[model samples]
Target: MQAYDAQTLVLCALADGPLHGYAVNTAIERLVGTRLGPGSLYGALSRLEAKQLIEPADDAGAQPRQRPVRLTPTGRQVLERELRSMAKVAAAGLASLKVNPA
Candidate 1:
């Protein structure tokens, strides 16, 4: 997947709650039918953290090596906006092709 797509997937993965690296990728895999590689996953996490879109969760019971993360409020807003934008694009593309979605 493209860089932005990976980042967006990361954001979507954290939408419901916090997750560590592995769980995040597992969720993504369930959604997309493929898991991201280590570099892609961690890189997207790092980028999202840098952008203040995601942050370490307050999971006191989490393992020392596993840092769970959740989306910030801004992240939620961004995700909603992105999803809407993608929906619009998809609708336009399908309409242009005269294809009715099931």
Candidate 2:
């Protein structure tokens, strides 16, 4: 799918641990205050699975329809790297901006 941003957000959301769809959406909302629609959420999940960035951990005590997902070791590494890149970009952007101090 074309949800690159959503994929990133999903990956970040799963960084904490395994969570199903609703829980994943909740975690993402907590982090970014943006609620992902079902389509976007599922699409991102599918793409990440295809890329091997995420995997089905286990259902365990979850509801019949709830399948929790977790990040693979590679996924964690990729997320960490992406966060570092984002931080650098944010720092550079802030450095380039002119702030007027009173």
Candidate 3:
């Protein structure tokens, strides 16, 4: 997947709740039937954090590498908007091919 796609997947994975790095990858795999490479995963996480879309969760006793990350309010809003836009595109594409969504 493209870099932006990876970032979006990361956001979606975190939508339900905070998840540590490995959990996020697992969640994404469950959603999309494929796993991201370590580089793609960490790169997306770093980009999202840099953009203030995600933040490390407060698990006081957890190691830094094991700490989970949660979506910020802005991140949730962004994800919703992005999903809506994608849905519209998908609908249009499906209609063009006369294929009904499952």
RMSD for all candidates, in order, please.
2.4, 4.3, 2.1
Better of 1 and 3 by lDDT: 3
Evaluate residue 42 in candidate 3 and report its C-alpha lDDT on the 0 to 100 scale. Answer: 93
What's the C-alpha lDDT at position 32 in model 1?
Answer: 90
Higher-lDDT candidate of 1 and 2: 1
Query: Model 1 off-target regions past 4 Å?
Result: 1-4, 60-65
Off by over 4 Å in 2: 1-4, 60-65, 98-102
Clash count for each candidate, listed in order shown: 0, 0, 0
lDDT per residue as tens, model 2, 1-102: 222388889999998899888889999889787789888999989888889999888766775238898999999999899989987876777777854322
By TM-score, the candidates rank as 3, 1, 2
lDDT accuracy of residue 84 in candidate 1: 93
Error of 3 at 85 (Å): 0.5
User: Candidate 2: which pairs clash?
Assistant: none
- Better model by TM-score, 1 or 2? 1
What are the runs in model 3 whose C-alpha is more than 4 Å off?
1-4
Ranking of predictions according to lDDT:
3, 1, 2
Candidate lDDT scores, in order, read: 0.89, 0.84, 0.92
